[model samples]
Target: MDLINTCFEMCDYIEQNGVVRLAGNVKLRDNLKKELLHFLIYISMTDGRYGEEEKAFIKKKLGFDVSASMAADIKNRNMLGAGYITRVPETFKYFILANAGHKIKNDRYDNKEARTLAETYRKLGQEYLAANTGSTEVEINVLSSYCVMLDENLKSYGLLRPDYKSVAIQAETADEKEPDADELIAELNSLTGLTAVKEDVNALINLLKVQKMREQMGMKQTSVNKHLVFMGNPGTGKTTVARLLARIYKAIGAISKGHLVEVDRSGLVCGYIGQTASKTAEVIESALGGVLFIDEAYTLTNGKGQGDFGQEAVDTLLKGMEDHRDDLVVIVAGYTELMEEFLDSNPGLRSRFNKFINFEDYTAEEEVEILINNCKKQEYMLSRDALEEARRFFTERVANKPEGYANARDVRNYLEKAISNQASRIVGLKDVDKNILAMLEKEDLVGIEL
Candidate 1:
């Protein structure tokens, strides 16, 4: 049986044997039971369909079978609506632990099942602590079992044990040192290629710095919108540049935080009405003190007509940009032409995003440099002939580029294939030395088409 089925069986045993009883008031007990049932049903439905086994298990455990209509209502109410459980309250948490403990006893303390149960318990406990602040000392004691279980499970899984004391010391030794504006600019300049893009970013940084200085010197200053549009092809480093822009803004005091929250069309757009706004707002809230990087942003408007919720996502995003203009920088990225069409689709978008940075595709030489960097990162070396072959391969690949040609991403894939070929070549050799093991031969690059 799967984990959820096992949990249901344990719950059934507990209910029939009266091994654990709820100690709360009648209403609280009923609510906790309802929530617990909802959680089980939600978890079971995670695989996309509720089965006969699940229904039978629920009927046997809870003493009542739900009709098809009732089951649909439960799914729509809990999974589709606001009744989906994200946090475990104290009462529901106890119910889970009670059933888990009974399962452990019934299984005669089997280590494997115990370890799996421990992980589930720890996840739920961590969720509770994340959602609540003023937990009582007794409640803390209960949750502390989660950490104990985690440690035990690590050992059970034969993973390298963590050093908590050293971790705590290292965390305490950390300092909140912020990078200066020049430092961030230098970092941006150090990236390979993108000369024009770097120039535009540097100019914007200078403009922001001058504005800040003007404010300090008692001069009139205008409000500047920091929203941006990054137009580029796939693997052209749009996301990477967006990340650096976040740090640049933070260093120049334009934004409060330097973190980057990246999302695509699916992250913001939802299936139902009234949910797209909440979903988009939630993502924006997480990115409040940082940057929200929306990649392939043109896809947000790819829907057929008004039936699509993509427009709702765009409207919510525009509102977020206006409301959090000071601390949040939203960078929408996509292919150059599609991004332009997307901007023109909504006047509000074009008005808010005044700065446009175009990321050009990498040259064949730049692509070779990126491949070499990847090799160095993986501690692999290419023979002289192999290196020449790689350069020729990249030149040809870019010359005969396909529709979805990912510049850097394609290079990485080529390197990965070469590495795999090298592995297949060397895996059977018994007399291989360190140099032989680390080197990629020209033969490794012979059969790669792209």
Candidate 2:
């Protein structure tokens, strides 16, 4: 059977199970249930081997306590059997028909939801290879490709699709091989002033090399722990690092694709009731096989009372994290205290994200380096005296300012203003000499002075 059809079958069975109803007569949308079941199956088959580990992972994902009876039932059924088998019952035929009914009847199917269901379906079908299906065989690689199609179908609903390309689903090609060292170095050079941050990221690159080697050796490599939290003040290169990390992740095969999709409060949240989950799920769908960076993620819990849409966003985000664990890497960035509150607000959030990279406030010397780098990019040369003056000005006026206002961003603003001021001093003068240029200066740095 095609993977999409198999996914529908699994969804139907899962939704009909007695345990499914135990969550109460809660109106679980058919689309949502189908997508959730699809994710459960995907994580279980992570190593391309479906066994006890897959079952345990499924149970956790579905929020089920694996009882003895549940264990016995899974064993009897062909759910987690090794290799592929096509013994799915005829009764399961209703699922495919029912799913098809929605499309045939009105054609009012939300492609967003359909795409999500499709993704889950494609993943399940790809992972669970039947033991032996004769000479007319289906390959897991082919099935993974189908999942990408569904991802595109679902993404048609978004306002503007991201520019990054999705990785091809070919088992002949392994994801996460060693990246070109030169490319990695070029990217590192583009970033500035965070020596420690650069080193940490390089370490992750080396780790990926080791992981790729293990995969080549036929050893069960430890799952790449891709989860990370960026703890830092603003403009300290957290987001830049995240974008680079996505490329590295793709290069090393942590996810299927290495795109960077950014969203803050506006993307995943909704003010109305019953809408946040769908909204969040849609965002997750777009970010599959990529990095989903949530800047100021702590603000997602703002506002007073249960009516706050922020909480819904959080709930929705956590759900997506669990469902799309194998396909995406989420990086939440915000100030230290706010991030603390964010972690405290959700147990699942705290548990899944274990790696934290702290971005410290830049020192005076580092701030000077940053300004010089910015100056070079802007094609402006600051005289030695002007540069020293700008650095001293920033030290007194920006960095020493109050906690909420101090950051590398503030330093950049200072440099921009100084450049502007120096430019303004050199109006319509055709042949400005080096001596005249050397004397350029700014009355004050950019941004409000302390």
Off by over 4 Å in 2: 1-182, 432-450
lDDT of 1 by residue, 1-450 (tens): 544345445444444455455455234335444654554455444444555655665565445576646667887865532333334344434444543444345443232333334334433333332222232333333334323323332332332122111221232333944655544444455455676677667546655654565566575555667888999899988887787788778877898877889999989988998999999999999998889999999998866386988889999999988888788989999999999888887889889988898999899998887777678767788899999998888888788887778999887888889989999999999999989988999999887965
Cα misplacement distance, residue 30 of candidate 1 (Å): 85
Question: All candidates' lDDT scores?
Answer: 0.66, 0.57
Please name the candidate that would achieve the greatest lDDT relative to the true structure: 1
After superposition, candidate 1 runs with Cα above 4 Å error: 1-178, 304-306
Models, CA RMSD each: 23.4, 22.2
Alpha carbon deviation, residue 17, candidate 2 (Å): 77
Q: Please, what's the RMSD in Å of model 2?
A: 22.2
The global Cα lDDT (0 to 1) of model 1 is 0.66
